[model samples]
Target chain A: MTIGADLKQCLATIKSIEAGLSSLAINTNAEDEQRLYHEQMMVIEEIKQDLMKRIGEVEREEEQYKGF
Target chain B: MPEWIHIIYRGVLFLILLFLMTKLLGKKQISQLSFFEYISGITIGSIAAEVIMGLDNNIWHGIIGVAIFAVIPFFVEILSLHNKKIRDVVEGKGTVLIKDGKLLEDNLKKEKYTTDEILQLLRGKDVFQVNEVEYAVLEADGKLSVLLKKDNRPLTRKDIDLPSINEKEPHTIIMDGEMIDDKLASAGKNRAWLKQELDKQNVTIENVFLGQVDSSGQLTLDLYDDKIQVPKPQEKPLLLANMKKCQADLELFALATDSEKAKRLYAANARKLQESMDVLSPHLKG
Candidate 1:
């Protein structure tokens, strides 16, 4: 996918993760909600890593194609 | 055999036998402890002690006695699980201690719990005032479960009609003056961008005590041993210098007219600014 398409996917993932965390925070018992939030946050971080890697690959490809 | 060795062996054997018997009786046996089971438990321990001390020194006799005790409870549990009437007789039904905020005197009397004991249980749940309780159940395990009156329960964001916003967990990007590459990437950030943001706030990469990025793409920065001293209005201009830089970046990125390109750049720049603000805003004092 293009950089724009990749970024859009990343944004969507982040938004979905945020929704999961918010629902988890409100619905879980007090003793367990913190753990659930932390786990969801880890998933968000993984999405961000994937987005950055894809962005970097796109940039590298663009540079090579430009012969610079 | 030495006296101590014999004593230790007997004690260990007795404990093992007790555990095996308890396991065979199932979880409800301990949880509901019927009159028969309770008496049997005490009697079995006493009998086991006598057998251990060589009163029934024949190991086979001791084993036979234990087998009988264990087998009876084991069968009773299996029967109880299969038959509803037998289960009710064994485990008993849940008794209502408080119904519609009024104490159930008859139920309390049957359960042998005083009003003070009920009050103590409520207090354990952080419900000291009796008026706050709607329903209170005395569980089979001898614990109280309380449901609070609607007015007494704390108002949630939804109850107050506040707009529900998505909340995300913050990611730790730096700790103890070390950059966490994994966290940086997870926050949709890179080393070069982070370094630049840190530089803008007059904080070297090595001087950060803690740095985190929240889900909203906000960066929070703390300097090494830097106490959170709020900057005066006079210092606001200097402290908020990065905020302007962020706005300028957003404006420049906005010049890309193509919707797709503009959106990507917008997200990237927003994340960058967020990282800078996370580091700089505390000092800005607003």
Candidate 2:
């Protein structure tokens, strides 16, 4: 698969993981576990954002190449 | 031979013979033994006791009695091993005491188990309610095997689509401040590697009360001094953090580059790195 496709797949996985962590944070009763899950969700969110930005850059470059 | 000397010799001989017989019978727990095995065990013990304490001068009689008891069971066990009929007769079939949340009254009567006894056994298996059990069998060994109803069963990793992880048993490489060379070898490691790991943690082997190499090849130490806390291994997490940093650096490079080709190259590599991280994140992530 192309790098853009790979990035999109990674973005989907990150989003799912972030959602899972969010669910875990909400479902758990312990304060420490909730905090840990929330922190992990935030880290995954940052990665997801980076992945989405890179996907956009790759797709944009591919479009420019097609024009040439 | 004097009376006391004869008794001592017989006692020592029977003890050794019984020990050998028990070893031949295999290492099954008492609760797991068949009816024949149980009877043989008790009979042999009683005969051994009788022969040891009996003031009679016939030592050959006691030896022959013990031999007959041991040899017969050994042959019976062999027959039971080869034939299903002998096995079933020796180890009676498990009675289905409960099926589909309903108690089999006839089977309970045959097994001479009261409802209260069944309930107590179910409680032992952590099942307080009868309707929660889909099936309950009274095994020949008297163990109650209860299968919970699908709705009542606890959720497992497979139920939630989680990948199964098979972990190997951890090897105890150090015990009482002494290194076990064989255990270290079993874990596929050596003295040089162990020394490097010990040095990395700044711990001396003599100070470690117990040291284990886990399935992931990480060394965990229990120091003799309780006040000192050893740091946990962070190799996987560290590698994950490094990958994230590299991806972020690439993204920064992509943004700073004036040329469009360099921007494309950096962004493409960043995405590739992210893909690699995605595959490893399950194992690496806390």
Candidate 3:
């Protein structure tokens, strides 16, 4: 559970949620309904991007603790 | 001529004529009948009854009268289809009893509905207070349509910005062990897909009293056999909280330990758990 490992796990969890939202969007055939599900996917994507930014910050700090 | 002979002949002839007349009329249920239709139906039925019972009254005269009554409504229904003004005249326009929380006294008096009667209708719609009513329309059928004030109204999905739900209706796939072909076709699914779903649930068509497939692909089966397995609801946030508690313990252990290697290992596990939980938090709130 190093910073690097933790960031990967965080990224994985967010990716799974994104995948679930994507499947929901794809399964709905109606254009309006697909749009609605994509809205939720968009919200989740925003969160995933925020986590990715946080991961970059964590990776920078991991340089300090690499030997320890 | 024998009285019994006349009774039987008139009764049988009128019954068949009544059946033919009603069959020509569209399949509008009693609730859907407009004021003109209701009166027409009653008049036609009364003429048929008079022809059957009144021994002296010429049956031909009664038949002609019944035909005229039926014809008028049939023509009126046809005319109403093409003319909106004629429809309004025949069916009558809905009168507004309450608008913007104010009682339209003139309209209510014109409709011959008293203050207490209007209040009763409002209460029937679950609006006990007059101030809560935004609009109350008295329809031609004498039924009241009440819309509550915006502030008093129940919340809709749009109010909270919830995503629009699937508009496709649930289709009955199976009923009484028989495949409903029309419903299945409407759902855009075939028998093979239905069988696979039933097989996934370990249910056979013979045992299924009813089966419906929703737009979300959720299949609901009701078997002739009363026994059922209800899915237990998940313990969601509680499960998350317990995991969080375990992570907290790992963090504490990492802080208290003397060995740097052991500390880093435990702390790393803790950090991973913390990140997973952080990612999960917003979903739990939503």
Give the winner by lDDT.
Answer: 2
Using Cα atoms, each model's DockQ against the true complex is 0.04, 0.03, 0.09
Q: How many angstroms is residue B89 displaced in model 1 relative to the true structure, after the best TM-score fit?
A: 0.9
Instruction: List lDDT for all candidates, in order.
Output: 0.64, 0.76, 0.72
Q: Rank the candidates by TM-score, best first.
A: 2, 3, 1
Model no. 2, DockQ: 0.03
Report how far residue B7 has shifted in candidate 1, in Å. Answer: 3.1
Record all residue pairs in model 3 with backbone atoms less than 3 Å apart, i.e. clashing.
Answer: A1-B268
Model 1 is docked with a DockQ of 0.04
What TM-score fits each model?
0.46, 0.70, 0.67
Instruction: Locate the minimum summed-lDDT window of 10 residues in model 3 chain B.
Output: B230-239
Candidate 3, residues B1-286, lDDT tens digits: the string is: 8999999999999999988888877675245457887787788888888879998899889989988877888898899989999999998889999999999999999999998998888888888999898898999888899988889999997888754454667788899999999988887678887888778778789988988876644567888887766222122344355446646655765786665865776677667656655644443323
Clashing pairs in model 1, backbone N/Cα/C closer than 3 A = B219-B274, B219-B278, B220-B278, B221-B278, B221-B279
Per-residue error at B82 for model 1, in Å? Answer: 1.9
Error (Å) of candidate 2 at residue B166 is 2.8
lDDT of 1 by residue, B110-220 (tens): 999988888889999999888789999987657788999989888986887654444556789999899999988766678987787676566776777888765544457
